[model samples]
Target chain A: MVNDSELCEIILQYVKDEYLDEDDDTQIGPDSPLISSGIVDSFSMVSLKTFLERKYKISIPDAKATPEAFDSVNKIVALMKEFF
Target chain B: MAYADKIREAYRKELADIRTAGLFKEERFIHSPQAAEITVEFPSGAPQQAVINLCANNYLGLSSHPEVIRAAHEGLDSRGYGMSSVRFICGTQEIHKELERKLANFLRLDDAILYAACFDANGGVFEPFILTDQDVIIADRLVHASLVDGIRLSKALQESYKHNDMKHLERKLEEFQDKRIRLIVTDGVFSMDGDVAPLDVICALAEKYDAMVLLDDSHATGFMGRTGRGTHEMRGVLGKIDLITTTLGKGLGGASGGCVSGRAELVELCRQRARPYLFSNAIPPVVVAAANKVLELVSSTTERRDKLERNTLYWRKALTEAGLDIKAGESPIVPVMLYNAKLSQDVARDLYKEGIYVVGFFFPVVPKGAARIRTQLSASHETAHLDKAAAAFKKVGEKYGILGLKKDQIIAKFGA
Candidate 1:
């Protein structure tokens, strides 16, 4: 089971790996706003959604696929827990 | 100091609103020259190479053509680099006039005027001619952003119809029937959805309403028609459209330039009045020479166009047969539908890992809940390249549980 902190780490790793930008140190917490902070854009959000679905094998409903669930790694993990 | 802090807070709030809505965009870094296949070297050393390049506007495979390169090299030697002057000044070269003449002849238009880009061409078009409030501009709702921006900058009364909805367009025209001069503007092919406008229908509507039709054929110039003459030729209405604007950056030679081809009078008027042409430096001699060569090649041979058509049909059929949703179009721009943004992104990434280069389109670039992978077929891409891509897609579709089950099973389970 991936915990919120673990999920945050994984999400960060994915961003770092895919974007190849090692300088992004923006923290992902339960209250952090990924999109608002300019850390994630629409494309990155899609990339994150794919990561969550494939890694956790959980279906994220369209209604639930909002910033409330995906704004931060912590929120995403919490949302995944609810779905699970 | 306190006021400045408050302003910063407001800006941050607006950014927060955008973030909350999932509309922000982050640009990808491309370290290599634009080509059919490219290597994007990132900082982390996880090297990825992809095919079926989705993001480029390189419609024809002329960007890196040997003939184009040779012409560019010759121009560089003959003309010697930058002009640093506008066309009316000292910037105009023999090649500029030659390319412009070739473009006009190729499109079978009376004359043509060159610009720094298609955006500039659109930006300069409306403001110069249609300044009166009595004039009307009836534009398609889904026309390119440049056209919208151009319309906004003009004083003309602007109305828009729904995307490709001719009845709505007619209704808009009826509402503005008494206007002095009405212009119906549209994209020859919508870039995102891979859908073509009902150009023939629109042309008839223009004739009935006494409106002038202006088509931005950036996506259709070198790849739409049988002989690659564009939307007018494709629809069998070559002499009917009043104005045609297109980008040389996409299909011509993929260098960097744009042009407007139409009536001799309109072309002359634009040359004298258009700000970009009047103020901006002309296209470098090298690019103009290269573009001339490209037009010559396209006019002489239909082999490249035929190959592109065949490639488009094959990819569309194979992807659809694999049970993937593909937006319908005969053009090279093919959209493989993946409603979930994350799924689309994963598919693109996984495909990249498998050595297939494609990009996923999501919200903002596309509408929300309508994310897709916008794959573009190039005349340069071989059958083997396409086959390998399709095989990889099939493998990834099954691996990601996107399309593994039988059709009936999927329909029964998911209810279509």
Candidate 2:
């Protein structure tokens, strides 16, 4: 089973691969704002929730996947912990 | 009395907060008809300005067509005025029936039922069919707000996949395999980004999952495909969509009615049970006659839609070549991305000063950071109108220093 830091890294990598263009040089840290910063839009945020649910076999409630919860890797990891 | 005063104070503070956050929306009064050029009074009492309109839903530019206006006058003279009741009572007229028949034939569906508006059609469509908790509705994440509210009124389990992501939709279909009925609903074209749904692939997925598909083609009804049959025709999935709800308010003559055209049994079911259809007043006879004329025109020729396509191409190319960030799509809706809400508003306001009529979309209408000025093209727009609009956009874009900037750069500049 993946630990918290590993899960965070995995989510971060998934976001980077799916959302960011290859030429984009913007640095994304663990606590970097995603949704609020225009990095992850609402539709992309739903896709992220789907990815996490499918990968971890955990269903994140819609309420739990709010923009606030999905705004950062740290926050997402915290939200994921509830389901795990 | 004291409670009313407290409520008033609360609302006053809320409105003040909206203004403080630069999110207050102001309306523009249009003096002329909704066409390529319109006279507008901004901020209520300001002097009127004739601006090149880029924000209306008049896709085929039939909103103020002379033929359509004549048809409305004829309808008014013939059908009297109001229905005075709902369809179940006395609102159903001969012209209404004829329009419904013609619409179903045009849409290539078995039958159709009219509603007061597309919002009413959407709100009433789901509840009648998806009757049990065993059923499920899997929809695109970025569907219109009407669908959201409609889904909320249904008893079925509601789910959403990523927008236009076939793989994600397939996974959702896989996960919900045990559901009694899986209804997949999507807009024919997403208005914000001007992207068409991949209905061909969506239909295939629905077939594989043994599900049904419902399409809301409000944005693509009159000018999306080769023969103007909407996205289903454009995507080569004609007759595959189980249900289609569309508005007469947009591409279909810019009137005030909507309809649910679909399989015979489903439409009959809505006719019998859809609350909005059974209760709301029938569409005005004038609108019905005008819409009938519209369908007749679109059915005969592809002239207007073709012009719209060419105009869209020219406008999009012009904006892109002028170094503005434009969302790429096939529809006439062109979104000029301005990521920051205040930046979008400022750019739109400046463009208005340059005699271009447009509005900035921000949070609540769109996502918070995905703010944009959605510029729509019409067949009414001539080359001169498009040229002038593009030049105005370029001027305002330069004023905001947003020309040629990438998304990240824009965000970095404006704090999105």
Candidate 3:
């Protein structure tokens, strides 16, 4: 099972892999705002959810996937704690 | 500062943020009618130039059809310019009922109820019938904003499955079976990527779970399937779906109106209780007549749909061959992916200068990093029109050094 740090690293890596524009090179941290900072968007958020679900072997309820709950790496960690 | 001043400051800051994030929306003026070819003025409101229209929802090429225009004029003369009241309150016209009946017949459903627009039809459908707390609504996450709002007002326990993910839908259905009622809603064709929803699977899952299905076919109604019966027909799930809502503002003559077609019971209840129908003024008679005629055209001959299908297939092939990144789908909405938002905007602007009209989408509209220039094809576009549009895309993509970069390669190259 992936710990919070491992999950955060995986998420950051996945986001960098999937959601980077050619012009964008900003580094995202665990406490950095994801959705509000425009680092993750609606589409890529789904990718992140799927990635976390697959890697961590957990289900993310619809209520937990809202911007309020999954907007940052730290929040995602909190949500993971809620489920796993 | 006063509260009003603080409010203004908040609004100003939000607007500035949007601009800074490169997500501010700007509309272009069209000097001519919506068609496959149109004259659009510069954003500066300077002299307009003719360009092949590639962004309009005017599928099947009926928006400016001579017959539809003639019918509109005739309806205005025979019926009146407007209805001052809602359908039940002194606004019921024989033509309105006729259009509703024809729409129902076209979709092979028992009945259809007209709304001022499809947005209204979607808005008004849920709240009247469902006891908000007892009913559960499961929707595809990518459904139109109108449907999303409608579900919200319904007070139903709403859950969203991933867009077009049938497995997620099945899981959601299994979870919602304990609820008194289960309704699954989805768009027939997602307007952005143009990928069709998996309706056959949805119907199968709905049957297994004893749930009803609602399909918003606004993007597919006039040009999909063997007989243009919308997405249900295209996916061979016709006569299985419980409700279908569609717009006349698109493929059906590009006029302004919408309708919800379903079982007789649902239609009857919606007629009496749907707020948008009961409170809003009736659709104009001219638009009703034009929409009715458009239905006739689509139902009688498959010529227009056939042309549109050919155009879409050809354009998709051309773009694919040109090494541009596009979602591989049969629908006419072809999103040419340009990962960089600024690049997507620049490509759209350059394509416009090259006489092709399309719109660029960025973050907040679509997901971040999935920026694209969405291009829609109409049956009215000729060989020359499509060839020119494809050539313009190629020229622009080559100029920017942004072409053929697949999903995996996007971040590495553009992550800079």
Candidate 4:
């Protein structure tokens, strides 16, 4: 089972792999602001949601696609914890 | 001392910015040809088969038409593949002139000039003719990116009105009253939103403001309005538009080409001055011939357009009746609003799993909180295909709790 910290790490890795940016200092933690900081657009949010759902086998309801659930790596971890 | 390293660092930073902002775009590989049914092969070694493609711009279903294919093959035999030179130099073939003439006749325009892509057609327009400091170009905020790029490259004073907001447009026109020439540029049908422009009203305003109207009918040509003559025909203001640009990529047979149609003088001016047309290699004879065949077919019968209209109405009505929030429009582009980006993505994935191919669009393709599954209707789709697609939507909506449980369950229990 993927723990919250592990999940955050995995997501961060996915981001790093997809972007392949060497100078980016974007850190993934519970308090990281992904959407609010304009770090991620709606399309990336969707992709992240799908990645989580497929990776963790959790069905993210439409109602939970709010800023509180996806605003940061930390929020996503919290949401995953709740689902698990 | 290390320019390459510095450039790489900048690209890395840019990539990080894009990743953080969720602006990263990925392309799906469609292994098979673009048709009503296509096969997409993912990197995971999974191949998915989808029916009645809802994302292609093959509006009149002429991309793989037998007649079009035949014409292309004939052109390949007659004119060879490519000219290897720009039109004025040595690329101007008899068939290119024939295709241009046919397009002009089809659009009911005095003349027309071809471009490599609609992007090029737009990119080459405003720069040459409208760059004077005395000129002003008032454009819709939601015009295609190509138009925006062209306007950016020009020296004309630019003013943008809110998307489809006639009042804002009128205000902009009034504000540009002092310019020597004021050009009102807009898309005949906004592609992403699938809403038709009020060309009649716009023409009236242009007349009142003494401004010329330019319509990019990329989404409307060979599809919208009666006989698929586009927005001008739909609004009964055919000749009123000063300049019109449309893609041969979409409804005009999915050939990789574009054309600017209007008064003979404007077209001649573009032919002479438009950098893309003057410098770029002419469109291959195969594509030109195929487009000519498509024009001939669209002009001959309204069958394809009528069928597409029927499919659009059926899909829109059925989806709406099932309680799905569909964007209001009479065009073939129907946007099923799922508001939530995650839900929209899931719904599209689920639909694809059920053999109905569609794409989920979110910002910056649309505004925030307006994510949707933009489903396009083609003349190639039959009643069964549309119903199947709708059924897939109902299932996905139910699974994701987007639609009412009872209604969705009822439909799912009794398979359509």
Candidate 5:
């Protein structure tokens, strides 16, 4: 089983690579705001869910896929842990 | 006056914020009817300029067809204009009944009920069927706003799967097995990407889960299948869809009307309980007659749809050969990917200067960093029009140095 830090690292890396501009130098941490800081939009949030589901073999229901649950890597990790 | 004065400054600040965020929508007034070519006045007081239209939903080119216009005139002369009352009051005319029957026959469903607009049809469809808290409404994430609203009006438990992700949908279906009822909702064709849904798979999933399926075919009804029936026909699942909501304001005749076509029992329930049908005025007789003529024409011949298919193939090929990045699909909606929001707007403005009328789609409409110019093909466009549009697109593509560039390359240059 993937620990919380490893899962957070995976999600942070995916967001940075898929959403951020190539030259963007803003630093992202485990607790950095994704949606609040405009790093991820609604569509991007869905894609992140898909990525996690494919990576970890889990299905995140629509109710649990709320914006607040996906605002930070730690929150997302917590949400995924419920399904696992 | 006191209330207006109190809130005027706040409204101004809100408008200013929208402008600052580049989210304000500006309208271009069309001086002529919607067709392959039309005169448009941009920036309010500007002189009208004629441009080739590539942004309208006129797939079958019946919006300004001479026969349809003539039919509208005949209907106007015969039936008179407005139905002042809603259906079941004084609004139920013979022509209205005829149009609904013709639409039902054309879609191969048991029956159909009309609405003032597809928005109304979608807005009022769900509450009657997905009744009670034990029912669950599972929909695709990318369904249109109308469907989203309709689903929201229901008191049932709401759920959604990833867009076009069948496995995810199946998971949802399996999870909801213990629910009293499961209704799966999806768009027949996604408007932005132009991709058709996998209805065959969806139907099988519904069978396995004992669920009902609803399709919003607003984008694909006029020219999607072998006989232009719908995506149900294209996916070879006619009569299998439990509900289908479509619009006549688009490829049908480009007028203003919509319908919910499906099983007779559900349609009866809608006629009785769907608030839009019972509350809104009837669809005007002119539009009804014009739509009847449209259905008659489509039912009689595949000529227009055949031409549309050819035009779509030719347009997609031309754009691909021009080295522009575009989404791959068989539908008439072709999105030329520019990746940057401002760049899409700039390219659209440049294309307008080149006499091509297309609009840029940016963030919030689509996802961030996925901005594109959505170009739609129509049967009205001749080869010369297609050739001109392709050349102009290449010119704009060259001006922006976006030709032959991949998504990452374009984003690297423009900062998506």
Candidate 6:
């Protein structure tokens, strides 16, 4: 079972590798505001939700697939825990 | 919860979420006419100083050209304000036909037909021309929202390749060859990034697959090529596209009209069957007349187009030298990419405070973390205006620390 920090580490790598554009160079922390900081967008969010569902075996219902649900690594870990 | 109440409560939650996410769209109304300089009101109700306008689609600066405005007046006098009827119901005027003829000549197409707007033209195109089960519509993933909606409305099977990926397009074309008809549609110039389509490759692929090509050259039609005949001319595929859709809202006169122009039979088919062309009220005579004047001006001399290209190159260089992460583009639309959404908004606010008017683009307008403020150059923007805008950008960008990679980050990324 993946712990919260491990989950955060995974997400941080995913964001740096996949979501961030070539020109962007912002540092990502557990508390970093992904959406507000413009490190990710709606498409990125959708991709993240899919990643979470696939990797963690936790489905994010459409209602819970919002910024409030996972705008930060901490929030995403918390959301993943709800299913666990 | 009761059914209606639950629905209302769900919608209320969604609205609240949008506000929290900063994705809610906000509008700013301009106080002056569309030009190089205009006044606008901020959301706080404070009157902003006259700003050097850089956000408009006024490519040729004909939005407020004296000649175009006078032509509008002349048109009003000679042809009246409006027809107040659909084209089939006594709305088609002699001026409409004349404008269509001029558009055909301008595009070097065999014929042309006018529509309410390019959006309507896109909406009406696929349904009439290729609405069948075996008819496949292949599009670039980033084609305009209007074209996507049009494709959705048609019964044709839809397939999209990666944006501007010719290899992916070839694969899709090969896979869909078993389909009876394949229609490939793409934008001549994608508006968001100001990137010209690889029209030459697309045309060649169309020939190989025996497919039809449609180019919505809305952003390119006014002043893109050597003689401003749009993407086809720019790409050296002049008069090769099967169908073309373009707008007057941005290019010609900056009023309102659009046309589906191309080969005689294609245009004639659209004129006879396209819903938007048949049901929508005719293009107002004044707008048609103003557009005619704009076309006349464009045809007579390449002066405005030349000036616009020069302006685009100058400021793109200026902004890059100033250390802003400006996208190097050939078109007049230059985007200053700010990865952080809040930073994008903050930078735009600071620029506005410095009397430069540009809007921030975020989220759905572009991919996530790719927020930008698109600045459009016009022939009307003088050197002084360009210098002022660039200076303002430099100032605000420094304050926000948005200019190129910081010294420390640069060292870290590059390894001193």
Which one wins on DockQ?
2
Residues B240-346, model 2: lDDT tens digits: 99999999999988878899999999999999889999989988898998999999999999999999999999999999999999999999999999999889889
Instruction: Order the candidates by DockQ, highest first.
Output: 2, 3, 5, 6, 4, 1
| RMSD of each candidate relative to the true structure | 14.3, 3.9, 5.4, 13.8, 5.1, 7.1
Give each prediction's DockQ, rounded to 2 decimals.
0.02, 0.19, 0.12, 0.02, 0.10, 0.08
- Look at candidate 1 and give me any clashing residue pairs: A50-B342, B50-B357, B51-B357
Residue lDDT tens for model 6, B303-337: 99899999999999999999988776788889887
lDDT of 3 by residue, A1-84 (tens): 568788778777766655554476787878888888676545336556755765677877767689878787788888898887
Model 5 C-alpha lDDT per residue in residues B238-327, reported as the tens digit of each score? 999999999998889888899999999999999989999899999989999899999999999999999999999999999999999999
Clashing pairs in 5: none
Ranking by lDDT: 5, 2, 3, 6, 4, 1
lDDT (Cα, tens digit) per residue for candidate 3, span B109-172: 9999999999999998898777665688888877888998798688676667767878777877
Worst lDDT window (10 residues) for model 3 chain B? B407-416
**Candidate 2 clashing pairs?**
B323-B404
Cα deviation at B218, candidate 6, in Å, is: 0.8
CAPRI-style quality class for the chain A–B interface of candidate 3: incorrect
After superposition, the stretches of candidate 5 with alpha carbons farther than 4 Å from their true spots are A1-84, B2-4
Q: After superposition, how far is residue B256 of candidate 5 from its true place, in Å?
A: 0.9
Task: Please report the candidate that would top TM-score against the real structure.
Answer: 5
Candidate 1 lDDT tens digits, B1-416: 66798899999999999878666655555656677677764324545444445457676788888888999999889998889999998998888988889899888899999999999898888877887868988887668888877886787766666568787788778867768999999999898887888889999999999999999999989878878999888888888888899999888878889999998988888998888789899898888888889999999998888888898899898887887767888788898777767777778888877777778877666754567889888888788878888888898888866674543443444332
Cα lDDT over the full model 5: 0.90
